[model samples]
Target: MIGSMPILLPVLEPDAKEGDGKEDDSGDDGQRLANRCFVIGPDGGIIARYDKIHLFDVSLGAGESYRESRTYQGGAQAVLADIGPAKLGLSICYDLRFPYLYRALAQAGADILSIPAAFTETTGRAHWHVLLRARAIETGCFVMAPAQSGHHADGRDTFGHSLLVDPWGEVLVDAGRDRGVSLFTIDLDAVAAARARIPALGHDRPLTI
Candidate 1:
């Protein structure tokens, strides 16, 4: 597995009173609300740990609400860890929306990127595949997204289609709507070849907007 920092946070107690002055109907803590990391070596032994930088806490209608800020602390820095021949860039779900982060990772020599997410069904269905492909095409890096699938204990549904995309914006492998591990062997040479062909990373002209 890629060695990146996880943005960790603590779980918070629910608010005592609702707008109706009734007991709030929040569920028990079933998930570990912390940013945690596990470094798996070639032999499959953990080698490091890094916390996540961002948290997901929002109410997406239908009485669904989350407040991750109340539970976990935001991560302070980005993690760039070495994994075999690749410099892996680590990020979570919402982080994918920010292109600058991916650009920075590319500039920092990241050949592979990981974005593990529990995306909402609505957003994932609309933009998940397109966004993943775009990032891969833009950065010339392999993007591996192992996502949380199906409904959670809290009655929240997540879009679960774990994807592995290559530098040329090709879908290498897709684990569709399942709760199991998927393995893939990616050739690192593809990154260099793609970057060499396009050379977009070196063509940054100051433009007047």
Candidate 2:
């Protein structure tokens, strides 16, 4: 059984009326809160939570569309947490596309990155592997992605190729189109070794906007 539910990171949007004392209804904000992942310690207690800053919104095919920003709020802060043996960076699905977020996490000393997703079959088939490997290579961190696969009772199908990538951009394990567990050992030392060889993280200079 799961230990607990997600911790919410609330976002605030400007109200329509701007300044009439009741511009935005505070009551409804909770419904549009951030998608967060709790960093659970090995002892089964909650240590920290990272609210998903990027929401998934796209049109896949005929009669398939999603608008997460309409239903869920976007998070503004990036968080890093320690989970016993590893320093992990927390993020959800769509956040994977944003490099800045992962860089920030790596800069904060994350050895591993966890991304939990229910990725649509269409996009996942095309981009999942490439993106996950890129992030791992760029940040020199191991990536742990647990995903949803197969068609659900609601007739919605997800492409599940859950991946475990090492710091050297190697696909250590892949749970391809199956609903099961994939086990592998993560050597955190690899993170340090890879970073030491490439050292790209330290050499990046802020680009002038």
Report every candidate's CA lDDT: 0.73, 0.79
Per-residue CA lDDT of model 2 for 1-209, tens digit only, reads 13332222222343222232323444454355556677655456678876677877788779888877665666667878766567778888999999989999999999998888888888889999999999999999999888889998967789999999999999999999978977567788899999999999999776987
lDDT of each residue in 1-209, candidate 1, tens digit only: 23332322112322322133433234544222446554556556554444556667677777777776555444556766677567888777777887878888888889988888878887889988999999999999999888888988888789989899999999998898888877667889999999999878778779896
Summing lDDT over every window of 10 consecutive residues in candidate 2, give the lowest-scoring window. 1-10
- Please give the clash total of every predicted structure, in order: 12, 0
Deviation in Å, model 2, residue 10 alpha carbon? 16
All-Cα superposition RMSD per candidate? 7.2, 5.5
Prediction 2 TM-score vs. true: 0.82
Question: What's the alpha carbon RMSD for model 1?
Answer: 7.2
TM-score for candidate 1, please give it: 0.77
